[model samples]
Target: MPQSTPSVVTIGELLWDMLPDGKKPGGAPANFVYHAACNGVAATAVTAVGNDDLGRELVSLLSDNGVNVSAEVNDYPTGITSVSLDANGVPEYDVVRGVAWDHIAFTDEVRGLVEQADAICYGSIAAREPQGTRDAIYAMIDAARADAVRFFDINIRSGFVDKEVISRFLDGATILKINDEELPVVARLFGIDMPDESISGQQEVMRELRDRFGLDVIILTAGAAYSIVMGHDETSILPTPKVEVADTVGAGDSFSGAFLAYLLRGYDLATAHRRAVEVSAFVCTCSGAWPAYSDALKEEQA
Candidate 1:
């Protein structure tokens, strides 16, 4: 076997968000891969696209951003979601179904590439379709277990995720990320407490999740407030930096990508946490999910 490369592999849907102005390439996996590349982590996105114009444009966009799309399929029409922005510029999505991403067929090359990765990032939303793509994701997870750290960003979209799929992904995950609201839902699914007060209570909730799921790291984001990072023995709170918001479209995904990028680079949890905050804040300053970075913004920490 060839030597394994220090790269992150993100697997999920790749599609365009039909915004009020036009279409923008946006999906959880694609957004995460974009930030991973921006942070200087060699990253590839394993996803499927359609054989249509939207798919071609998405491929071109990924190429221009230096994200590898070699494992991307073009068998069906590209996936698309309609975005309706609220007064505060937050987007509510109406995701279209039966797109190419719903039937993602994994090739031998995709399996090989995943096996060579240092980390793999996936989410529950992508696993909630057609059953074939979900199986493909599981196959990659099983094959990459020895070499890759599986980071499960449990992006539970309504009408998509169910209890069984979330439980299965958690069983295979090394690290997990979820928002404050989703935490309670997941805890209830696992029959844990529905807390009402205090960050300590929240920490306990997270600790229970880690202990039950065998998680090495658990990240919980409380929007516009502090985020919590919990390990087996340590727990720390990192504050979200105040910044002018363009949109909150991919802030969570960017945070997950940056955190993984820093951790894989051998940074301590505190350092990684800080880096995640900074990178996420920078992303929120721009309109798109994955914002273009300047050289200064991409500077590596010593």
Candidate 2:
């Protein structure tokens, strides 16, 4: 058992995802930290929010969900993404630029938190435009313990991520969590030839990337199909649990959070991968990125 609670810090965007029904609190880092906190870790969200009603609501919601907010208040408006769900419940986002989260300021306090973290998760989207935010993210990653789990969830949002940013982030990542949709894109970007479309071929591609980046793990999640977790010597592949479709807003982020949480708590890789799958399935059945973890939900996971 851990001597104390495991610390997980996520530095990235924290914004409201404007859905068709209403605005839902959603962002990769926010959702990741929220799930990590819910799973009984000391999770902190190191991002920025606008000093506005929307920002206040976001902070309050995160606190209510058990995530510690180490957010900076900035002059710009809070970040918001207009989300449209397809018939299959997959989301297409029209993200707003120049928002508050795009202007995160690196502070000594954030550096301290990163230095002590057991795991840190960041993404490409948050570091896309703002040069300062990208620098801050790099600094925090540098400050983290050498043995820390540096999870880079390459959340390649449209019009945001490119080869340069993705390659730089991968350089520091111990674990790279990406979806099947993104795998091909990355493969093309890096000129890694993918001649076959079989599972073995996919694993080969993943292995090549892992070796190139010195990554310890590579998680390839195929929504509604299967997910593969590849470590240095072992690989665990599990079919995604079938559940009623809601919206896959933060399902992938939840998986990364749960996986890291279990690992930090001393669980074996297979067990951690299993639990992450279960948690991600539960999130897919809920409405927004963050569904209330009521007693029933807790029992289901148990």
Candidate 3:
């Protein structure tokens, strides 16, 4: 059954991040679901896992973190990613393919949750790999309520992204979040290579994406340089807050979650943007993605 309050749904992969030291649960959408729940949103994860030990552990971790996840069990093995970190704690992932989440078939449970969701989050990877769940992923995206915020996180991983997949995701997305690295990739895919001034170039790129994709809001994140939120005849450039370093594995996902959670809770866009930046910076100071929300982070939670 759906909850009484509005729900935020993350529709994508749930798998283990096999770190150099040990393993932890960390997929982009899973990280978003975890951080959204931590920041006081009614969060649900709509993805699949294999009927295996790894799958069981992933479910237990989600439940323990206060996320609602009764994922469908697949016959394949659970997804896993091997991670290695740089000196600055930036992580590189060898994300596995042909895992369980790559085949999320349409079901009543996914349909019910999505139909009632206020915001539905999805990544482009769900369409790239294996190509089995591509139809099912599109079906779930179509199932969202008409007023729901269809947030498309262009989480480009490895070489999985393609022009067709990116265009397909943009067809119905209300909001877009892209990092500096991926911005160039998007431009190249769209056949744009214009050179302009620093700020103007960024704004123009954002506007191009907005106009091309019919996005209501465009969030451009430049790690440690600045973050730009463009919408409604205004552009806000917020400098990335400096913080003590931890691995930046899930910082971007946290930003996406916090921004949407604040909006779902009725805060203004500017405030929500600020909160997202702050929360993401805080996450960078912690060890992992789903850090406990302590006195350090100030979210207007229930």
Candidate 4:
């Protein structure tokens, strides 16, 4: 049901991740939009940045990498997160507060883009901030076409999400992307008690969530183990491929991006699920979230 070129828009934070070695461009929505564009979509990132050198460089980095950047220049300094990688390459973030992205505005241009977008992705991090930006994100989703793939990637960070906020986003989402680590949090937030923590138990929770929210699709990713995709009538489960890890900074975001990209291109559910797993596995072996596509990745998309 997509046009010739599926147009995708991601509305959320745009910031630099201060990793142990150095800084890199990151933010769930920005990373998602970048990977979506890499997989052959017209992808745009909508967020705010400071009127500073870092902000200009961040915008330029995204633009140079094929993502259309629609950023509001504001007075607050650009956002940054200190990322510390554990022994297994998992990341723990200390996110800076009161940054530029907390002040995202709803301009006419952003409204038009959202209205026409074939798919839109947003997360909880940016919406957890000052009230105006949260309202703006909701407005953008409300303006999207009724059939648009309103993807809600519940990127829950500490002190950023609660039951009320999660429920509000679920009420509007057509597709929900969650990971194993966040699944328990979501279950508790929704008051869905999980007596069994096995794979089947998780799928039951996913099914209940899908039915409750009237969601068309629900993707549950378990890092380094497996992933599951539950469609309206079918379910696809695939084990995660083993790969050497640089860091897991954006592997999950890459999975969401690649899955949506394949779906938009008319691939079947199973095939899309397989390709997304491959893409995320490839991302795991790379350094940052937006790595250059290797031949293996290109072939997987083809």
Candidate 5:
């Protein structure tokens, strides 16, 4: 018998990444949904796009990749981020503001989707936008089932962040994902000390966040270096598997997606961490986040 797929609903921006070569569909929430689906979970994306070519293509690409879309068509033009990669395939983004996703209005449809989700993924970028978008996200969170896992990927971009906003989101998040740099920034904001010279201090930082936010799990990442996972029972720090370079656009989001999917599917933290690191490394070997997932490539890496 075919097993049921764990359902994950990701809410936030969906847009094109206008890379130097051309454009591809990309956004943190969209990347999370795509990789979650790749991890054998039933994933859906709740975001917005203009009713234009870019929007249509974005939706079609997501659907083709096996992610369900609950996107709203808005009057603003579709969102896009101009991307340029450094020599090491690390990318810098100039995100376009005031797009369709900026105006994602609250609706019964989004609420219903959240209510049905086993895990709901969101990012700081959405709430950093218009008041309406933040309100819409809060409403969806409110409608989620009591036990639904609220995964917050702390994707801070530009000046689109503040301590108050992050704190408010933490009140609802069951899981938190942040990069190495953001960890110290967050620590300082909450009066948690982060000692650079000590690994135990780092763990303390993670534990403080976990306890402070009442989070079930915490994932801290360092690009192409390592990642740390702290939980109620155990904590593990895993080095990123080596891989040939490509533009690292959605690598972090891919990690979050895979970790959540594997965890929901009953994998232990260590096992899930390995898979998450593997998947994220694979993403670094591809040009974009929503790359054409290759079974052969995955097996070869394995």
Candidate 6:
């Protein structure tokens, strides 16, 4: 896998996760792109930032990390969210609405990139917005269907997702990734059997999704438990590596990014699953969603 070949295009929100300590540059798509870059996947992020200082900082961060920022916009002020941590260290966010990301207008350049993409990663959170960005992403999906592998990383944020949006994205996706809690919600919405309220039942739900949608892959994450990877021909489970948590912010996004990176490099489901879990563990050992030392740490783990 040569580093020069562009392997992925992640289209979605690019914002700052403002922790109590300070602001951390994040957004699911950006996090995925970060890990993809570490895995030698030539990745580009198509997102928008505001014309404000925060947006400028985000662009600088991306540039410093070796991520391509040519498609990132600076028309609107950058989006910001204040994150509050609980006693257990779980994060709760207060998202500022109508920010820069809400104005992600599609352009001829974005469409052209999508048409040339090898893989595309997006999520439902970015689609629940002022409608313009959502429309742009949907358009890109339609245009990229023939030549790209669309990965729907269903990062369902509270108050930022709806059934219609979820269904629409699922229909356009070639692969789907969701955390344990979201699997049942999506399965029941799609008229798939909810089955029993167990992890195996969730696996059954995923199997139904794969069979019904003809999806190439389905990834399910269960926090610090084991994660499941299922394809048409095989299934594999990998346990999360035991590590002291700094914060669980971008662990799932890291998993999604690493999984796609390995898959694109022609790794088997089992091996990819292990690598995804390992990278996610590395992320949890750090503070923010897009950790500063991600690439070097990942190389050490490898």
Instruction: Tell me the tens digit of each residue's lDDT in model 1 across 144-188.
Output: 857568999997675675888888888888899988878888888
Go through the candidates in order and give the C-alpha RMSD of each one to the true structure.
2.5, 1.3, 2.4, 1.2, 1.9, 2.0
Show model 2 residue runs off by greater than 4 Å: 294-296, 300-302
Number of clashes recorded per candidate: 1, 0, 0, 0, 0, 4
**Candidate 6 lDDT over residue span 169-282, tens digit each:** 888898999988888778767788787867789889998888777788999999888889999888998777888888887789999988888888777788878888888888
Candidate 6 off by > 4 Å: 1-6, 71-75, 294-302
CA displacement after TM-score superposition, residue 54 of candidate 3 (Å): 1.3
- TM-score computed on alpha carbons, candidate 6: 0.93
In candidate 4 the C-alpha lDDT for residue 71 amounts to: 95
Question: How far is 167's C-alpha from truth in model 3 (Å)?
Answer: 0.7
lDDT of 4 at 209: 92
lDDT of 2: 0.89
Worst 10 residues of 5 by lDDT: 293-302
Give model 1's clash tally. Answer: 1
TM-score of each: 0.94, 0.97, 0.94, 0.97, 0.95, 0.93
The positional error of residue 235 in candidate 6, measured at the CA in angstroms, is: 0.7
Top lDDT prediction, candidate number? 4
Give the distance in Å from residue 243's predicted Cα in candidate 6 to where it truly belongs.
0.8
Counting only residues 3 or more apart in sequence or on different chains, how many pairs clash (N, Cα, C under 3 Å) in candidate 2?
0
Candidate numbers, best lDDT first, in rank order: 4, 2, 5, 3, 1, 6
Model 2 RMSD in Å is 1.3
TM-score for candidate 3, residues paired by index:
0.94
TM-score of candidate 1 to 2 decimals: 0.94
